[model samples]
Target: MPSTNRRCPTVAAPPQPTDPTSRKLLGRLSLPERRFVADALRAETVGGVLLLVAAVAALIWANTPPLAESYQAVRDFHIGPAALGLDLSIQHWAADGLLAIFFFVAGIELKRELVAGDLRDPKAAALPVIAALCGMVAPAGVYALVNVFGSGSMDGWAVPTATDIAFALAVLAVIGTSLPSALRAFLLTLAVVDDLFAIVVIAVFFTSRIDFLAFGGAVAGLVLFWFLLRRGVRGWYVYVPLALVIWGLMYNSGVHATIAGVAMGLMLRCTRGEGEERSPGERIEHLVRPVSAGLAVPLFALFAAGVSLSDESIGQVFTRPETLGVVLGLVVGKTVGIFGGTWLAARFTKAELNDDLAWPDVFAVASLAGIGFTVSLLIGELAFADDPVLTDEVKAAVLIGSLIAAVGACVLLKLRDRKYRALTEAEERDEDLDGIPDIYEEHTPEYHLRMARIHEEKAAEHRRRAEAAAGSRIEGDRPA
Candidate 1:
């Protein structure tokens, strides 16, 4: 009785070290995140195309002999209540007011990502976040190096540090049909983080003078905004006026007014409450994103991208140190930073590249990240506000750099897409011969029923053919 022994319970083996899912970068996204990303991509793609058109129109208008004066006059015209210190030029209104809307949408997406999307997980967040940081830093470094050795102002370093998500995604959507979904997700995340950093750079580096009273008022308004939303207060009439006041205060405060939009967007509740169909953030984002994409952004591009395309201006892009720096920083630095950073993180940290992606896919996306159109132009404007000539040159450089990146990315993405398409076709063929594809394997019963119906029809056709053949033979034998 004293010698009784107890049997131990079995323990399942831990997942193998070689398991593909562990620590992978750009892993499968949740259904909601996937849908959100897809919708955002579609809108951004359209917006990007519109932005491109506007930019082209602006360039043409600016370069034309008769239209150039009219374009300049229109952009320079002032409107807004002077009592509120808001009498800004049409160009300034586009840059400050409309871009705030764009930033607002970005803030909502960033908040959602932090609260519920991939960024919620530190492991999942590391790759894109790191890559984005490196992407920004490398570009700035390149710009700095160029300016240090040449006769150019260093103020435009941050210009090349920004990546325009809309343009990059637009190019990808056009060419990456058969490419991995993970690549799109990776690019989106990288761009979002890139935007956050760009916002910080703008606020920190670009401020003119301190209007502490107005700045304090803006902060108080932000606090009130957070308080109201937390109290479940709802109404466009209430928040709209408050937001406009805040934006005005922020604009008057000498800090970039776009910061106000992002702040309010971040404060909005992201998680859905009970009995709610969507979160306040989601609903507001749904309403505002279309405006930001379709109206705000394109208008901003129209005003911002109207640089002269004359031979002299074109020559300045390559000859001027600041403009040349922007070009190299975007085309060369972004690619090296993102791709090299990914490799480093995967090698040193627990992170691993997703099995569905190769280094080439990452390289392609990195090249796409160099499309620093929208924010780059904004930064260039701020950097050279005193020098119209320099600003024009910088804008031209941004366009040229972005074009080169887009073309390079297109070539690379096309190759990757072709490879992926071939592989997909092979898989479809194998699946057809071997039974239901893995995607339909979940609907096993329905698939089985469908296959059963198909087999039965085939069998029925064979039976009819056999009966006809026998009848023919019998008829021949009897009639002869």
Candidate 2:
């Protein structure tokens, strides 16, 4: 009556000690931060799809009967302060204004990687870093070779050097592949460095003249901005006007105004302070990224990617040296440059691909790197500004080249995805259904002999306890 046959209560197991170094090696973000990144990535994927749709819609509008004139009118419409020589067309505003937001997001990502992510360790980051550099250089070289004396100015050599990370990642996500996370990490690091190189190229080579007065004003503003950030000034009221002043000055100074975005992003403090729960930089990025991805990029793409192919003959469009060069440089140059760079580094250094990846995986990623859209279009505009026909050709070529790269990457990555799924299935095989895989407990060889022995001892002790409990139950029943 008093529950004489009641079973003994079971004690809960203590939590296992986690290895901090292992977390570092895995490069795992904290739960909240990881979720933030995931949300940002998902937003970017959606943005990429929207960007594609905008570009396509623009092209359709440019070629269609009634919408063509309106589209052209909108693209040509200019309304800014003419006193400061800033009254640029709608297209120019999208490029010089909205695209600066995109560059700001890029700057934050680059800084984050440099400070806390994969690029923190030079040795750990060497492969992708070197590959990105080589990737940029090779494309420039290829484009130059094809267009040296053919037709267009060689200033557009940098046109095909960029890789649009958002578009590439969006394509990968659409493929629904189950590849290792390392592949995504490598792509991101490579793209960040690639963007850095592209920015440097734009600043150094593209600037025909520099106004020292304006430049000095920009520098002063930056200094003030830095000083305020150091003083923990968090209000947008103080920073917004200052930032606008800097961007305007930088634009007048013949340096790209987008550089201001990068400078401000880099200056934002990322580490938490004593009284703060979150870093100001992270909060700012979180606030600004949706604006950048959802609005700025699509707007820029809508303006920049509209190439009216209504009049050009097939032979003329395809046979132009600039078009040929840009297409080949994006498709062939990027693939060879990134893949070859990675291969050469692996051969020379002790660095190897992750166990979950192979050379084929790297090759596929290299192909994905060729999806150079937004920045490629911007560079095309810059490179062939004097040649309108060539500019349109370059835009069309970017679309074609990116499509080729996307298709190739999807096929290769999908195959790799299947392989990973098989491995995951094997990894999850648990014979006893105890939530612990027998494979993990039994697969340790001599290197993990101590752990194996401990596991065996624990198993035997569990068996002994179980046997004793059975005997105790039998004795209690007999006594009753």
Candidate 3:
């Protein structure tokens, strides 16, 4: 008789969805995290509206003759070690010192992607990776072409590489019904990848002179941070101390302190699912949410969004290749590059087209993806501070590009409304599908109304106009 040993089989846990929803049960967040998440989500859906509101406020303050001084005073308001002992400039602090938090949040998101989000599966991420590469390359190529022989031209290559998440999300929110969630998800993945690429480029290509000793300290701090992370220390307690050290070291390292921001973000991992996408909020991301969303981003917007428009502003932008390239790259190049890249990629890869998205819809989305506000502006200062002319051009380009993307998204979404309306009509006709939830109910008011109502209103309006015309004709024929 032989003695046989059998191992017990472990049952696999329930499979999560391809993209798990984050409206999950969290024990509780700090009061700030709760308010911050609430506001950040609102910002994503309405950042454009917020931008519009802010712009209007600025316009009223800047143009209303009496309030102009207040507007100028606000821009001139300066702070930092200048009042205390350092050469770090105002723009530098806003972009480098403050926006580090944005990078930290972005890094958490990137970690989530690699671990469980869209990039969870190599195959799943392939589509976005390819699309993102194309998206980045095409715009840079287009920008370069636009600046072939122009001044400040060399710096223009990076213009089309950035995708403002706020504006992109705003477009998705406004487009509510026209575009699919899948499309929005796809765009977000591509943008994140693109941002990662841009960050790398900045770290490698855009830094000032290197301070070897300080850089060594920064690198050591990063190594220590990585080790702490690997030890499964997920608390802000560990990260905060190291973040301060790394940031201080990196500032002296001459590698651009913003790189430290990205370093902090990328080095850490976020809680996500396997073979499924997850949100950073699922983990300790709640802890950092307030600092990133509530404090950093709005402040970045407040400081960076301001563009002093003078009589020479328009002229200055056109003359500088850097400005022209950024504007053109973001606006024209973004549309062409995104649409062309997507179309070409789809052709070669034979990727399954998401339902209801035709070339026109694709074009609209591509156009929308070109909006390069926050990151673009941040880079502008980093790339061309010596040349204010170039910065102005970037500012102009960002404003225009973002506007184009937002408006384009709205238009395509309106076009998409027809299909949604039709689908709603079809769904309503089926009596057996009683419990089918209307995910799109929040939008589609016009769709919710019966088709007959639309026709009836149009017909009545036509009849009223026709009768008025007939009466006018009768008067003209009589004696006039």
Best by lDDT: 1
lDDT of 3 by residue, 1-480 (tens): 111132422221111122232221111222333333444455455545454455446545555678777665765566655432235545456677777877876777677678756577675677667767777777787678767867345765776688876667755665565333445566666777877888887887788699899899999999998897678666767778889889978887778787887877777656544763533344545556565655566556665666656657766665666666776777677777777766666677555454334567667777778888778877777777787756755776677667766776677668656554443343234222334323323135644554447678889999999999999999899964
For model 2, what is the C-alpha lDDT against the true structure? 0.77
Model 2 earns a TM-score of 0.81
Q: Lowest summed-lDDT stretch of 10 residues in model 1? A: 9-18
State the C-alpha lDDT per candidate: 0.84, 0.77, 0.64
- Model 2 segments beyond 4 Å from truth? 1-40, 149-152, 274-277, 310-314, 420-480
Clashes of each: 0, 0, 1
lDDT of 1 by residue, 1-480 (tens): 011132431222211122445777665555466567777788888888788778889989888998999999999999999999999999999999999999999999899889978888887788888899999999999999999999678999999999998887667666655544456678888888998999999999999897999999999999999999889888999999999999999999999999999999899888888999889899999999889988999999999988888888889899889999999999999999999888888988967665545688889889989999989999999999999988989999999999999999889888656445643443233232445333323346766666677789889999999999999999989954
User: Clashing pairs in model 2?
Assistant: none
lDDT of 2 by residue, 1-480 (tens): 012132532221111222344322223233343344555567677778778788888889887888888988999999999999799999999999888888988888778777766677786677778899889988888888888867555767888899998888778667776443445567777888999998998898878899999999999999999999888777889998988898999999999888999988888777667998667777888889888878999899888877766546335546777777888888889999999988877777745444444678788889999999999998888877888877877888888878888898888778667555643454445544556544444534642565567789889999999999999999989944
Candidate of highest TM-score: 1
Model 2 residue 476 distance off true place after TM-score fit, in angstroms: 29
